[model samples]
Target chain A: MEDKVKIIEIKKSVFAANEKTADDLREELKQKGVFLLNVMSSPGSGKTTTLVELINALKDKIKIAVMEADIDSDVDALTVAKKTGVQSIQLHTGGMCHLDAEMTSQGLNGLSNLDDLDLVILENVGNLVCPAEFDTGAVTSLTILSVPEGDDKPLKYPLMYQVCSLVVINKIDVLPYFTFDVAKCKENIKMRNPNAEVIEISALKKEGIDKLADWVLKQVKNWKENK
Target chain B: MHELGIVFHIIKQVEEVANKNSVKEVTKVVLEIGEVSGVVPKYLHDCWKWAVENRSEHMKNCALEVISLKATSYCKDCERMYDTVKSGRICPYCQSKNTYLVTGNEVSIKHIEVKDEN
Candidate 1:
């Protein structure tokens, strides 16, 4: 007599619920011609500071909204809201290192007037690993790497580099103090994402902000054209 | 870190399978992980160490097996598949730009082994 154990078969994605919600949210955003930019980066990598510059540059011309994901405080959400004067919501993920499309969809739900907006930015939790897996149905996923974090970032974390549409190198003004090689970094980025744009800037000093803004506007324009 | 979350998902699936089959216990689990999936086998084991222990009283002694899937590239020109190390986007046969991925990008529980009582 053999030991009796149960054997059953099931094939399903762990992200099934989140993926479905994200798809519907994406469809809703598409109908309104609103583009959601899923932004990801390591903690204190200047993702928020970059957002500040971006909002400061485009707020008057574009109806931009922000969904800031953080584990504890609403500081980032407040910072971006103060700069853009647009609708900003802070999503407390508690301790999750990533943001799935379900949280993002719920965050976007707070803004009922999304139909009138041109852009929606969902600031993902500060982690390179988990966030790359969640699609969120964002048209484009953007990542930030500050100069202090070393230029070897892309090679160390390839998936984030591979899937990202843009790699924004923030805090270039401090490049003189750091040993970061811009060329090698660009090469690494291009290796993984040859088609993705590389935007170099110092988000804090406001230097190169215009170029970054231009790139965002260009992508948004391209999205509108295709839509 | 996300591995535990994945294990939780797997546990739920395991429970469903057990309920449907009207079985007593789960003895083994088989998983195929892709290199591109960015999942470290060691980390997965560490996470599963805790998840499986907590999920089931019977599964406390069950085994988790991981099979690595090698990433391969596809050449559109030659309509052939090759390993990722030797090729990325270029077709080694024709050196053409038409290339795509053929395999090695997946994470699935392929099979589970168990004993059945009469």
Candidate 2:
């Protein structure tokens, strides 16, 4: 007797399951009137400093919280808590490179007073690659690129730029020291993503923080008011 | 690495399908991986081997077969398709950056091979 083998068709993307979960999570957040923003950047790209500045600028107008996702360590969450004085939590990915929809939902649940919060900023793991691939159920995605990291980053990491709605060019205060070109950087970003808005900032020096804050406020308002 | 995460998702999906079909064992899984999907096939295989043995019940010792797809992009200016890996976002013929990827970014499961009781 010969062994029998049957083939079953299961044509689906590997991300299909997660994508569905992300969509459902987005819908739920929408119903609850909460806006989620997933922030991605390379290591030491001034994400923590930038967040502190932006959160301080908007903390008065709206209720906000920050979830810092890292493979290990809780320093980011603590910094955001101490500096901006908003609700903050640390999510340990257990050596994973990125946060998926489920982890994000779990983090959201762990926050105190979730209903009262208007916006949640998810500071994703400091990697340019994996973070962009996984949808963290955020209403919008932002990527931070510092001037020292070079202007051709958009060309190198095309997918990251393509997925991000906003790209913050940070550390502009040190631009004179590096061979970074602002116009060329903007052109590269536009090539990859035409609609993605680029804002130049020096998070350390607090340059362009107001424009970034206004952008966040508008996004939150639109997320709440729009059908 | 993300390959591990992706492998976990694949295992979960395969488990659901096996449970739904009442499959006792899955011997093989076929995947369609695009050239520019950013997933390395070598890492995916390594992750799959570990995950199937440790994490999955019905897919123990399952073999993973990957079908590599060529990445192609459509140039809006010239209205032509070219190899994405070679030309990237900019079209080779017209040198226009106004282009979009048409294919080769997929990470899809095409089918599964299951063994039946005699």
Candidate 3:
């Protein structure tokens, strides 16, 4: 006797529904006049340090808030709040390595100062592979690529480089110490995403912070003017 | 890795589809994962084996099948397509710098098999 089975074709992405939810969340954030930016990087890529500088640069100009995502720790959120004195919240991913659009929306709802904030920065968990796959409903997506991570990262992890609107080459101050070539990195990034804007900065030394801040200001202004 | 989370997401989708069609027991789940989608098939299988047992009563002992899609890139100047992992954004035919990915960046559920009601 043969066991009976029925084949059902369901050619659907597990992420399709998440993408729709992300688009809706983007529209909602637009209506509420909030520019959300998702920042991703590998562990110890100086994301929190870079974010501290960014918050300082834009704090006087606009109302800012931060959501720090980690697999288990809330230390980054505490650091951001202590250093910036702004509305900051910690999002424990509960073993989820990346934050999806629904998780981002839930995080936004958890923030009590959404009405008073102009920008919401999601400091995504430090991991290159997973965070890039999920859209967190942000207006812009940025990735921090430090010098120590090597220049061939764009070629190895092309998806992360491709999805990012901006790629910040952090730790430029340590460029002399490492064998990282800025031009090579830029070329590789261009191959993945021709339109991605690349900026070199050292969050520790505060070099190129102005350029990054200017770009963020422009993005925020564009979001405000267009939406 | 985040493969466990991905497994949960897939199970959720499968459960939703099963409920919509009134499927009592899911016997198999076919997933189409691209070569460059960042999901390790072995890890995914491991997670599926664990999560399926714990997810739903109908999904117990379900078999997960994965089909790998090749990553291909298209060269603009050479107008040729090559395996992305082997070529690395350079057109092997013409050695052109202007190249872009064409496929192999997908992660989706393609098919589901259910046991017939006796």
Candidate 4:
């Protein structure tokens, strides 16, 4: 160890290159007319269930696909495939908590063609923290916060709350029974991201989903118009 | 949650600086952690304690100094910028949606104070 040569202090980001590549991937997705939605949340936040409902709602208006990123499991992809009857791919990151652009590009490469689809939702590895730091070629980042997760999640995980484009306050069917304060959650989320659009829904009961789907379609439309 | 990772980054930076300076002892590590970075100061300090305790030789005497930089969104509507504490998404001035983030997303090693054992 004494023989090793040292030098001046180098300030290098551990994630700078990855962020650049993610930006490149986002540009590529923009070119293909594919609006990518990177869905991130803690495990069992109704992300997949909401996706299934979304797929069912807009299958006629748009050709949709899904890339489910999990730590280890084909089960989610299978469920999505069976539920939506659309092309769904599974990405196993082994144990990594996040998915970078390079990781997502691999999945995009495996897809049929970017031009053939209007939407590609990357169901990112479930976590409010690490995935927030890594972008996965997504045009819009959607975060689902379930009622069971509590309202303080926005305040607790400010980065995720701030970066998210849409905040889906899920599990609304049980809102009457549970102590989850919907308005409080919205306030907390707005405290972290004033521009963050929030929608209340129950993925399990298929309630308030039309508005969510509409918000997504509207985002796609806005992206096309603005871009 | 990501405090450990940041600690690792901090250690790596301090090690490089220590090696470059060729000083035996490091008195303090000055860190600039921006508000809204989702890193709690206490948690980061705790992580630093654990991470540095495992470090060898000159790292034992290192003191941590975390400087919090508060970031706030400025509303263009009222053309007023208010001092917002860490992790606020709304603008205190006009509450305009057109406001953008000013300077909250930072995790950098601004400066370090050191002394050589000589």
lDDT by residue for model 2 (A77-116), tens: 9999999999999999998999999999999999988888
TM-score of chain B of each: 0.82, 0.95, 0.89, 0.78
DockQ for each candidate?
0.40, 0.73, 0.66, 0.17
lDDT for B78 in candidate 4 is 75
Q: TM-score (0 to 1) for chain A, all models?
A: 0.93, 0.98, 0.97, 0.95
Residue B31 CA displacement from its true place in model 4, Å: 6.3
Q: Return whichever of 2 and 4 wins on DockQ.
A: 2
Cα-based lDDT at residue B30, candidate 2:
99
Best by DockQ: 2
Native-to-model Cα distance after best TM-score fit, residue B9 in candidate 1, in Å: 3.4
* TM-score leader: 2
Ranking the candidates on lDDT from highest down gives: 2, 3, 1, 4
The CAPRI category of model 1 is acceptable
Judged by whole-model lDDT over C-alpha atoms, candidate 4 comes out at 0.80
Ranking by DockQ: 2, 3, 1, 4
Which parts of model 1 have CA positions greater than 4 angstroms off? A11-18, B12-27, B53-62, B75-82, B85-99, B112-118
Q: What's the distance in Å from true for residue B69, model 1?
A: 0.8
lDDT of 1 by residue, B2-104 (tens): 7766676577666667666776677898887887777777888897868778866546666898888898887767888877646554567886656666666
Error (Å) of candidate 4 at residue A122 is 0.6
* TM accuracy, model 1: 0.86
Q: What share of the true interface contacts does each candidate keep?
A: 0.35, 0.84, 0.75, 0.16
